[model samples]
Target: MPREVRELAEDPTGVDAGTQDAVLLFVGGPLDGRVEIREARHGEPLPTVTHVHLHGGPKVVHRYDLTPLGPGVGVYHLRPQQVVRDRSVAD
Candidate 1:
C-alpha cells in the first residue's frame, strides 16, 4: 500500500492539485493516526467512484489523497475545501 501511495504522490503533474479526495487503502502506516477512513457521522465507508472509504472533517485545513487507479495503486494529490469561512459569504 505504501508503494501505491508513493506512485500517487510522486508525479504532481499526473494529478490535479485541487482534488483532495484521493482513495487509499490503509494497510498500516505511521501517519495512520491522522487519517480516519470512516465517515464522521455515519461510521461507514463512503461509496464513491473508487474509494470504499474517505476522510471526514468538521473543519479541514489541508488534505492529501491517493485515488485508486489500479490494483493496489492510486493517483495522488492535495484536495481543496472551504476550511476557512468568510462571514461575508453565505453558505
Candidate 2:
C-alpha cells in the first residue's frame, strides 16, 4: 500500500509556513520504503520524477515516477526508464 503524507514544509515565500516537513515515499525497486523530505509550496505541484545513482561496479541510474495518493501525498513507483552503464565498463 502507498503511504499518505501532508504538505508540512515551510514555503520560502512565507505563503505556506508549515511546522513539519513534507515527504515523498518510494515503493518498489531499489528505493522501496524510502522517505524523502522535500520543500514545497501550498499550491505548487510536487516533483514527478526521482533519480537514483548506484556506484560500485558499473554505474547505474534508476528512475521513479510519482503516483499521487491524494493531496500532498504520493508514492514513487519504479518505472522501466533505463539503466545506464558506465562507458568504462564493457557491455
Q: What lDDT does each candidate get?
A: 0.40, 0.64
Write one digit per residue (lDDT tens) for candidate 1, span 15-91. Answer: 54333333345322323434443333443233322222435844323344555554323433444443456789887
Highest TM-score against the true fold, candidate: 2
In model 2, which regions exceed 4 Å deviation? 1-21, 41-47, 81-91
**Candidate 2, after superposition: displacement of residue 62 in Å?**
0.9
Report residue 6 deviation for candidate 2 (angstroms).
23
Question: Per-prediction RMSD in angstroms?
Answer: 15.4, 12.1
Which lDDT tens digits does candidate 2 get at residues 1-91?
9999757555444443343345679877778899876666443335566565657775556667777665456778778766455799777
TM-score per candidate, chains pooled: 0.25, 0.52
In model 2, the number of clashes is 0
lDDT at 6 for candidate 1? 46
Residue runs of model 1 more than 4 Å from their true location after superposition: 1-60, 81-83, 86-91
> Would you list the clashing residue pairs of candidate 2?
none
